[model samples]
Target chain A: MQEVVNFIDLNLIMVGYLFIVGFTGGLVSGFIGSGGAFVLTPGMMSLGVPGTVAVASNMCHKFPKALVGAIKRYKYGQVDIKLGLVMAASASLGVQIGIKIQQIILEKWGQAGSNLYVSLSFVLILVTVGGYVFYDARKSARRTDTAGEMVSNLARRLQRIQLPPMIHFKTADVRISLWLTLPVGFATGMLAATIAVGGFIGVPGMIYVLGASSLIASATELVIAFVMGLGGSINWALHGMVDIRLTLIILAGSLLGVQLGAIGTTYVKEHMIKIVMGTIMLIVAFSRGFAIPQYLAQLKLIEVEENTIRILSAVSFGIMCLALAVGAVIILAAMWKGRFAAEEGAELPDKGSSLEVVSQES
Target chain B: MSGRSYARRKRPYGKVIGFGMLTAALYAAVYLNAPVVMTYFTKGGVYAVLPIATVFLFSYVHGTFAGSLWSLLGIDAKRTRLQERMEKRPAATRKISRPRPRLHA
Candidate 1:
């Protein structure tokens, strides 16, 4: 209904591509509680959106979707809002500081250097943390008696501390000091600013470092996400870079995906959450890792053909999409199976049974 | 049984229509003003309040509508376990202990 802008028309093709991207990304976000943005931003750019517009529009869409997902998950008693909010607030500050740091890098090294830094950070965090998560999940899945309890030693040990301004996250069932919580939120923001998805670190940091359970951590990350996305979107929108059409398109699919993802959370083990995140992260690392050499070539640190670089970039984006796709599949499959089991589990316990107390608690 | 049951419990049609129109209007206003609103919001420093304020506004208007819309559709969560848990709140609670004090790099 609007006049066409550039050659980039908001025709059926653009709309359809964005919808699919949103669906896939939303599916991933719902399960992992964070993602989609990393790929969404780039995906939009491919549709001829300016890099800044893609980021801003993606951010605009992300917060609402996250809010939707968080609320849905909260109903399941998974969200720790206070924790998420506090973390989000501090994370906002971290985003500011992280942006400043990026600006400094941008000034000194220019685009090539900045790109390298972003790429390097992506590889390091995604590979190390993602690999660790995959390993831990595999180990946990080997045991059946434990069922949904993959609480980390770090979280358990951290819960023992008594610091000032201590917050009690009822959902997480752990009370870590505000001092410890600040850094988690801050780092989460910093990394989010750098890598586009705070939950990549926020979720893991909560579990392995701050000691929140996976369910609580993933749910809580949504809070941090809404905060960061709001802050970041403002920054980009200020530049007049947000493409509202793109934002809305992504929102349509993500809203549905996130809702499904949130509901999907109900059917899986806590460790499955870790497994999903870790697997995606590790795969994404490979996705980004493949392009490192080309960036190096750009810096003249290595010699590579332009054709080679172009191929690597395409491959890299392909892998990123694949990673998101795989995550969506795992989450949906797990949720479906979990729901089936839950339905079966729901049977034996009749309305007036003694198990009513347990059902009510749930 | 299904969401069909939840749908039966939704508020009347008039209220739903009113809410929907209001939300659509609110979003229209925000999007139409995005360029200026967003620019001033991200000015940084004291101007940083712009972004934060807009977010709060969006959260309230957009967030509430989204929540209610989902609920009306019978897509609401199964009821919050956190609320029941939060009800057990006490006068004072101790913070979780930290073995290693994390430092920023």
Candidate 2:
């Protein structure tokens, strides 16, 4: 009795949609330690779910997935639980504040303006950060034919800060001021509220700004993701927006995907992780970028063809899928090459220069 | 720390039965009488119990299930290998510290 897509009922065949999206999105999350949500919410909406239900269900599913991923990484000694928790606590606070600002815009200008604001944020932040990560990864890949170098001068400088209350993060292998961490974590939550994908900022912030290694940053992100997702879901669930069926189905795929991705982390080098994270972020940014014009039209900045809008939305979703596909390929290929090389030798641990951090956990 | 010790321990059947019963009761409360459960869960009141309880429940049951299920399927992460490769996360860790040269020079 629910709405259909292409003559298919959203409520009925939703099971199939959930399974595929869950599996592939989970695959991406496992590789990058974040990003399944970017795919999940939109995938559900495409099945004719209300925007509220899609976001709520996605959040509901996210925490458990992150929890599982975190535990796996912990066993790998990649998670800085203390750091993740601190960031999570602050990020949740930021989420509330961000939500308040979103509400203000929504109340004042209504839905179109709110949607425009979110799309614009997504386009803006993703483009800036994602493009940078992608470029860095490409450059490093060229020099050494490996993917493990840190290109962010910012992280190195942050590490040199000698501010008070210095804290040591074992997995991250850095001792930095606690104050520096707050802004990164807070920005993560704010962006999460604005665009619903905070890891795009969180992972980069941790690696580049906070001076944590890519491996630890990606893994620790699961902890922060768990906290934020749980908090958001509860807020949304109180409104009956979470469809438990939808949440559970996605979890089925994600659980398996997270396990694989977690194991993958053991086999890859450090920089490869950044490569995957940056690649996904840039592609997703582009996906959001395409939708900006449509939202602008809604705000009457310009009037474009309705067919053009529909086509653009379709293209955005396609790019999102392509992002996931590319991530999976990078992870698999890197791991394969590593395993082959490791087998021929004495399993010599690749130096910091040659390691891949992100997918090694998977 | 070794897998050998883990292979020796046996959990009591009574404990397993008790846990199963508690889990069954929870499912009954949430799924069987969903309308009544939904009443409190979706209230959106100041109590905040509905959403908090749901996350707590999922975190426990589903979390454990995913963990053990992966182990059961032999999908566990390789501990020794991971210990070697884990660097501070790739995002924040500075693998390089070379400063840029000044253009004026």
lDDT (CA) per prediction: 0.72, 0.72
lDDT of 2 by residue, A1-362 (tens): 22221212235467776866776676667656688777788887887777877888788888878887888778777788888988888788778788999999999878888988887787788878888877766665564443345536776787788998888876676678888899889999999998787888888888788877767788889999988887787777656666665676677677767767876776676667878988888888788888878878888889999999999999999998888878888887876666555445445345443234333323
Say which docking band candidate 2 falls in. incorrect
> Model 1 over residues A1-362: C-alpha lDDT tens digits?
22222323467888888888887787778778898887887887787876766777788888878887887777666788888988888898888898899999999988888888998999998998889888887876664343434457877777788878788876666678888888888989899878888898899888888766677788889888877776667665555555665666677677767877776665565567878899899888899988898878878999999999999999999999998988998987876665554545443212211123223334
Alpha carbon lDDT at B74, candidate 1: 48
TM-scores of the candidates in the order shown = 0.78, 0.79
| Per-residue error (Å), model 1, residue A109 | 1.8
Model 1 clashing residue pairs (backbone): A155-A211, A160-B97, A161-B96, A161-B97, A175-B96, A176-B96, A238-B38, A238-B39
**lDDT of candidate 2 at residue A111, scale 0 to 100:** 89
TM-score of 1: 0.78
Worst window of 10 by summed lDDT in candidate 1 chain A: A348-357
Chain B vs. true chain B: TM-score per candidate: 0.56, 0.51
